[model samples]
Target: MAAVEECVVVIDGANVACQKDGKVHIPKLAAAIKYFRSLELAAGRYPVNCVAFAPNFWLNVKPSPGSAGPKENGTMETDDWALLNQLVHQDHVILTPSQAHDDFYVIDYAVKYNGFIVTNDMFRDHVSNKRIFHGKRLTSNWVRSHCIDFTFVGTEFMPNPRTMERVVHFQPSATSAVTTSSLHDSNDNDVEAESDDVQEDGMVVDHKGTKRSKTIDLSEVTYYKVPRELLPMLHGEGGETMGKFQEYTGTYIVLPSHAASAAPSTSNVLTLSIYGPEPSRLQAVGHLDAFLVQMQQQYAYQHQQQYMASQVHQAGMYPHQHQPSTGTQDDQMMEIDPY
Candidate 1:
């Protein structure tokens, strides 16, 4: 008998956590993981490597005491906490940074391992809009071929039987390997999604009443200027800010490289090069400019407050000590111009 190949799997921890009772049921999630690990690749060999990724908030899910609500009300029970701790210690769980979403990490691990993703999420935000990431659009065909959804039968949790059957029988073809490159090439001629209704004119209408073209042109590029001082805030720690913007807008933002980002530039302004469809690029630039404006306004507000405090101290007078003036209200009020 030929040896069966081992399979790698990435589980969406948050999606599994809320599977039971619409709350964070750690035991249900643990059961799903245990079930996946128990699946046999050979007669006696369990060849499943299942890893779960979650946002950092779930790591601190402490149970509240003396609560009238149910145990699964977004709080971990004692046993649940213990099980979660064991999973963490075993290195089976990856808690992503709190400032970022776990979607990227989940998809990344799936791609890195050439594995399958188990989640109920349609990934509409990612696949539906034909969003491009890392030079490839997450096409529906790729998602359908690589992702798995699950269901619960009372207290038992398991992946969908049909999907599991397909997964177990899947064999990568010589020219159809599920890699970044294959996915990129496959998206050039996208097959219409089975779940969506397609019109004769090559447009797809999803259940949510949103319409999108069957094909998109990702060659469009646009640029916008920003103050150099606000670059760090725009990037955020580990580039989470810009990453979120890309995820939301479905556009890839090209900023300075690592060395250039860190070094102070002689120019007071920097340019942001956004790449995607025309509407997506416009949306990204608009949001980026809005964030910069908000930060600038906040800085101006802080500066004004500091100046007022310094002026009061220099006059040796407290704010409350100011006597009422006989002048009009406008004359008594001090106006500070914004920067």
Candidate 2:
């Protein structure tokens, strides 16, 4: 199997709100870049690419008066929306959506890729409604959760130096492969196999005649519905409430009634509180950082090993038991294993 490639970090320039100080306040974007760079610095790191898109308006404005302007404007209202459109074309990794709008684009992408969506939006709880749109509605919370949960891929919620609430980890769908032998099977056998076993949902038949499927247990899934008005205050969990909230029972957690009315001491202070599986924010961040470091190291090691193998092959040092062979029928028939 081929090695897993590095994750792509897509920055939503529109969702990046500018503060009164004229600086963007997106620590998530910064963290992503830092993590990716760390991987590159390690040996044999897969490429970690980044793409950023702002409002067409930003693209329209010329750096110099003589430059041409952007072709269109107002295609997207906010940076978050711009980012969502950019993510639609991507094929892998966890997609981190900002807590803006309903984050419908995030949900749509998750469903399409069978990937995870990472966000701090409290309204994500409402994903269980199973409401149909354009004639289709998700019947299972597992599907809904996969579309909305912060940690759908594995663990959700890691720590950030800038925020008390933990960040999320998103994972892409797994790729399956087929073998050459499977494709050559007789049609009669294929028909008999198809008749004996029905294909289930989320199952794929590979070119090599291998069947891959994911079995989801409906009993284990839970769905929560949250009101829209309270969304902003319930957007993200704060460090102060991390302990209390993480212990809560519901699939989703909201701020206490009184807590919603309170204002942040400073604009920089996170006002929302989100509760989830892991309790400690710092520990979560440390774990994620460690995972990234490990991946980087693993990639480096693999590259080194491959380089060494190549060198050995080039030097003609690969093991051979015989003296150099001469042209002969017996020599031509002799089998050798290439390492």
Candidate 3:
């Protein structure tokens, strides 16, 4: 009889630790993992023939007395360590030796075994330019090839990524959603709409008045006008001092939240609803801030480079006639007497 081909998975044990109200909830973590495994079995998929790399403390440490397990007939029993030990010994999950670079280890195993990786990390956070090849390897090998996303939802492990549409976004949470083998899913479908040359009193021409940007041909695109007070907050500038334009009413700014087809207008201030189940939100404010800051930095860098080049050229043209200026180089004109 031919032996069944093994279906292995490389799990990031430490990454799967559950959190509740911002701290690790050991019992919850154990319960969540159990739930995660059950789902796979129910789907007729084999349990992970896998290695879980984590710190010694994580794999072996028992929770404090009365700190874990659910009440059983009016008695709370067992902690995460007890649970971990059982799972490790009985289940197909093997506890790997403690390692600082466990993520890399997981990636290596996946590559060697032609297995899938199960973790929320993108492998980018731990990588630098020095590890460019390593990063690329992890991304192309594990992420692109096969990735089983596992997330802890409320009190249980959500094994299927498809059901993650219900995960609330942006809002503060004890534990944010985690995807095991995701690449840089840049939710930046942002558009930087150019202000039409015909601007009178700061209002850009809505040339195709009420007509949406062509890039996204959505059957329905919802736009929301930010509260006049929150207007300053959305200006990309630190919402500190008010700009002259911000103090007035009717200075409407639209935030594109949900679109049936694609993202909003080609305007810089936009965000994506990447997590699906279309949130009734105006935008992902973080993306908006990022887009604005990036644009500002690019613009500043361009001007600075231009200024430096001009200075170098001027000095080269008149090497002998060079004289130190009284004011800063940026001060093109000195404060001189009108006389």
Candidate 4:
């Protein structure tokens, strides 16, 4: 039987190729993502399947065949360079560059836009980390927050970020009130969900019994149903729809994606929570841009080893051998290993 495909897998390339056991091989993680993605490659699906992000340094640094750290080489020929070139040619397994620590961009992309991530880093040390989960239960206040399932490819178990009973909110169906009940019970809350105005009979309708909008609040977690053309490859039993996330007992299949109210198109998205509400699907990713600025401040640069490097053993540390800084320019990424 052929292996089934799953959701998009975003990678922190440096995080995956950590040198913990000995000298870690750079291509091992690249091959893993490529192997899984190849199992489901097709049109629409796997078009840009496994997206990997690494610091630009990896493009030039040469790795000794058996050593852990990257060394400077006059020639650009090495296993690391070859793997990156292969990823570029394949196109499906795309490799991108991060302005700073690749981990932050990885976190932002996976949480805000894509639904699945593959890295051992859990960034709890950064103040920015609080913005995503904030110690909340891994259920959907919107869909299921803190519900990102992590896989180290060879880890023994999965993640459940908190102790609270997980809450799951399914996509409100067009015929929601009637069908799929045999599938499972809906969330038992008296306050009708703001997303879908549920009638006393659990029928979805507007106050006038006319308009049927499914747009969700910015504060809520919900899923746009996977497109009809993309569903088969994305939600197969063996796919990564649930990925490493532990399934709460009440729910089974991930309900399909569908058209929501005229909210912004998710072409290029931004994820944020503010004192006031401002949402834009096409907003330039200024948070990371701002973060990069903060990291480059004079005080931050000289004192970075004292402040940031102290976080090496903290959660969300970068998973690679440390590169000794030569203070070349404004392109240094946080490198440490704890998560």
Candidate 5:
């Protein structure tokens, strides 16, 4: 027999969404699973030798009576979100959490056999540079390194998309009320209204727009507004105020937290260094198939050798011992003598 290349698809049961808005959506979930299975078939037909499913702990839980929700059943929620959160903090192979129960057991078996992980959650933040595919397309680098591919064909949720906007802040003094009559008279007089644009500091209003050119102590400012998208990436101008902008903003930013660990390996680095290089999908598939075939052959050969050895030993030791002699009884008795 040939050695089988192992592959495991880790399903995030929590995200499976058997129900939505208090209504059963069984057909949707089933359709999603069917689509995922199709992708698995494609993988197996090419680079993958064998495929297994990694079920999450939540799948074992039954719905509770009334509004109590899913029964605890002594199992922890080993869903994709929780698993990814835990994996980010680990270095190498670590035992799945106890709450995982059977889910952990199954995952352990797959990892032990060098099976690849198939998950949709961006759990590979710690290893972001790894390559991960969504179905047939390369979706993320994180998945590529730690596992094989991430199939997005069945996902129900897409990460929230962000939009950018401009925000303006007013100084405390600028907020003071200005009489409407005084503003009208100033415009009517057109006496080159004292330019609001101050040479160095303070509030300044220009015909183009009211431009505030003064630098006020940040401590004096009561409130400020900043674009939501820019808020995450902003750093203070001076060393003293660095990261201060984020402190004032309630929202947290998502940045590459594991760039160092996810750095490409020597082989990957070499591959990338080549300029104007085009990736060859066929070549990659061929290489993977060759490896899988070699492993299968080695395993088969070892099994055959062990079986032959056992057969030879059994044949040599058993039949002769059971043989009965026709005239040997008298001869054997005659040979018996005191030493």
Candidate 6:
């Protein structure tokens, strides 16, 4: 009998473990392995050759009393220790060093095996860095094709076929040519609309007001407004803040330098064009709001310091005016100088 070729897969174990409502459930990792193995066998798509890479922290978790199932313990569950041990025994689990990201090892293994990746992570930060294998660059297209996403329905593993397809694509308005990736070099000066500028409705209006249709999927884009003053803080030093936030959320965030908005309005706000899944976009929004609160607090503290400094300066200039009354009422009244 001829030997069947193996279909290799590199699973992001940390990503898989946290698949259930953003909380780590070790059973999900076990279920994921079983699901893939069963799927390969059912489809007869060659013997499943899969390996999952995880951080050492998960490997160190101690299992508590449970019926070999998921048990909620604070933010994570670890009752599936038996399954984890089984995977380890089968040499299916690989643990990354402490405090090191498993993503690097996962992608490395995938490249070495020329295998598929299974994770919901978009890997936005790593995708741009070219990982060439078999003459194929691990670009957005490659990721979309090779990555697998899944969800859990009451501990039942349900794989999603349309992996990363729902991720929003970005298109800059006609008034701006800057995208999220190039936010660092973009000028923060107000962007005046050119003769031909496109609006949110995908309508390109010329200086003469002749409107033409431009194809854009508005559904994929999310628009958020922040105070114009926060542009510096939001962009950070060389767009560092925006870059970190984007990397953290796996989303693209562009702040066009204009009053230019999705709608024609004269508001003192800068519109943030965010591109990603809905959950990612919402997460980005929360981050932005938190940043805003922090900036407001800093500004308030600075204003208070300035106010105190000014008060001290005034007191120094008019020392008598700041002195407290030290005399009796009658003495103080006479000291008022009834000239």
| TM-score (all chains, Cα) for each model | 0.57, 0.25, 0.37, 0.35, 0.23, 0.44
Expressed as tens digits, the lDDT of each residue in 132-192 for candidate 5 is 1111111122122223222233445322122000001211122122112112221121122
RMSD, every candidate, angstroms: 10.3, 25.7, 21.3, 19.6, 28.6, 17.3
Give the poorly placed runs of model 4, Cα more than 4 Å off.
1-6, 21-24, 39-48, 62-77, 92-98, 126-129, 132-339
**Model 6 clash pairs?**
none
Candidates, ranked, lDDT:
1, 6, 3, 4, 2, 5
lDDT of 4 by residue, 1-339 (tens): 111232344666666665574333456656656544553433434332456666554554444442344343212236656766677666634444312335545655544442345555444222111223222211122222322333344632233334111212212231123222211123322123323233322433333311121121223222222223333333336655432221211111232222111112333221222111233211212332443354345334556656565756553476565566686434444452212
* Winner by lDDT: 1
Minimal lDDT window, size 10, model 5? 268-277
List candidate 2 segments past 4 Å from native. 1-30, 33-102, 125-339
lDDT against the true structure, per candidate, is 0.64, 0.32, 0.39, 0.37, 0.29, 0.56
As a whole number from 0 to 100, the lDDT of residue 249 in candidate 5 is 33
Error of 2 at 208 (Å): 48
Q: 172-258, model 1: which lDDT tens digit per residue? A: 341137554335642454334434324412555463422333333334668777766667667778987776677678776666534
Candidate 2 lDDT score at position 142: 28
Where is model 1 more than 4 Å wrong at Cα? 1-4, 19-22, 42-46, 61-63, 66-79, 129-135, 170-182, 186-327, 331-339
| C-alpha positional error of residue 295 in candidate 2 after TM-score superposition, expressed in Å | 58
For model 2, residues 307-334, the per-residue Cα lDDT tens digits are: 6567568657655633554677445434
TM-score of 1: 0.57
Q: Write the residue-wise lDDT of candidate 3 on 1-339 in tens digits.
A: 111243445566656663433234445546544544443322353343445554443443334455453332211224555666666676534554321234546665654444556666655322211121222222222243355667665765665555232221111121111222322222212121222122423434343431232122111223332322223344445432221222221122222212211221223333222111123122433343564466555555666677768877999999888787677855742332211
Q: Candidate 4 or 6, higher TM-score?
A: 6
